[model samples]
Target: MNFQKNKDEVFQAVANATEEAHRPQNSVKIIAVTKYVDSSIAKDLLKTGIEHIGENRVDKFLEKYEALADLKLTWHLIGSLQRRKVKDIINYLDYFHALDSVKLAAEIQKRANKPIKCFLQVNVSKEESKHGFMVEDIHQAIETIKNYDKIELVGLMTMAPFGADADQLKDIFSKTHALQKELQQLGIANMPFTELSMGMSGDFKEAIANGSTFVRIGTAFFK
Candidate 1:
């Protein structure tokens, strides 16, 4: 695949969608989900001006982390993390997009050497197949994790059910956006809830229209 061309196309799409949505330019960060590609492709992506890279598994994340350790890139761990793996990969990540439980937060607090930027994953759709806090539990979850100094709750992350239509995707993203606003009003310290990491390759435009700040794209960038 032509990584540069794909990267340009994705950026163009993001720009057009942002303008169509009346959102500010450069508002959405495109996290190239590098889980499916090898480190060589990831290095090529960095050369194309893609600064943010996401990996969903700890083993693969570390593999690429070791291979491309010299490049200046913002690394994102965008999958459900097992507590046991926290100590191994905590320091390498710039953002963790799947913090859903108090136990995990406590583990991160115990293991991280510095404040880790985290996006609490909310299962906004209440889908049993997804891994996140249910919508109703988010407020309490936030309250419980407030004392964990090692974690900086940056925002909420979620995925719409696969095969969802545009309207369905919009509803999911809009609801998550509203939740982010609600959390921000609480004025929790270090909780600058400014991001909404919703959307994937299929529904990113709808996600952008509904106030997504980061969109994770894999197939679009690799194909």
Candidate 2:
């Protein structure tokens, strides 16, 4: 695969989308989701000037993190993290995008040596199979999270339903952006809630238009 070509194309697309949305330059950052690739390929992608790397599973994240230890890259755990396995990868993460529960936040607070930047995952689409806080429960979750000194709530994340059409994608992302704005208005010290992680490769354009700050793309780069 032409890694440089893919990287350039993705950046250009995101820039165009950002401009079309009338958002600030560089407001959106892409996470090169490397869950399906190994460290060698991830390292190759990094050479093309992509600094953000994401992995979905703990074991795979550890393997790549160790293999690419010599390199300087921002690591993002963009998948559901089990509480029991928190100690293994909590300290290594730069950003945890799947903070779906306060119990998991408590676990991170227990294990982390430094504060971890986390995105409160919300089930915007309310899909039964998806994992995240329901719309109404986030208030209580944040109240509980305020006590966790080691967790910094930086943003909110949500996954739109698979095969969703443009209107559906827009609706989901719009609601997520609205929720993020609402949380930001709270002025909570630990919860800045400034970022929104709302898109994948397929529907990222709509996400950008709706104010997504981070979009996770995996298959697009690998292809």
Count of clashing residue pairs in every prediction: 0, 0
Q: Residue 45 in model 1: shift from native, Å?
A: 2.1
lDDT of 2 by residue, 1-223 (tens): 9999999999999999999999998999999999988889999988899888999999999999999998889999999999999999999999999999888999999999999999999998899999999999999999999988899999899999999999999899999999999999999998999999988999999999999999999988988
Which residues of candidate 1, in runs, are more than 4 Å off?
Answer: none
The RMSD (Cα, Å) of candidate 1 is 0.8
| All models, RMSD in angstroms | 0.8, 0.7
Best by lDDT: 2
Q: Assess every candidate by TM-score.
A: 0.98, 0.98
Instruction: Give the alpha-carbon lDDT of every model.
Output: 0.92, 0.94
lDDT of 1: 0.92
lDDT of 1 by residue, 1-223 (tens): 7989999999999999999999899999999998888999889987899889999999999999999988889999999899999999999999999998989999999999999999999998999888999988877887778988899999999999989987888788899999899888888888999899988999999999989999999999888
Stretch of 10 with least lDDT, candidate 1: 135-144
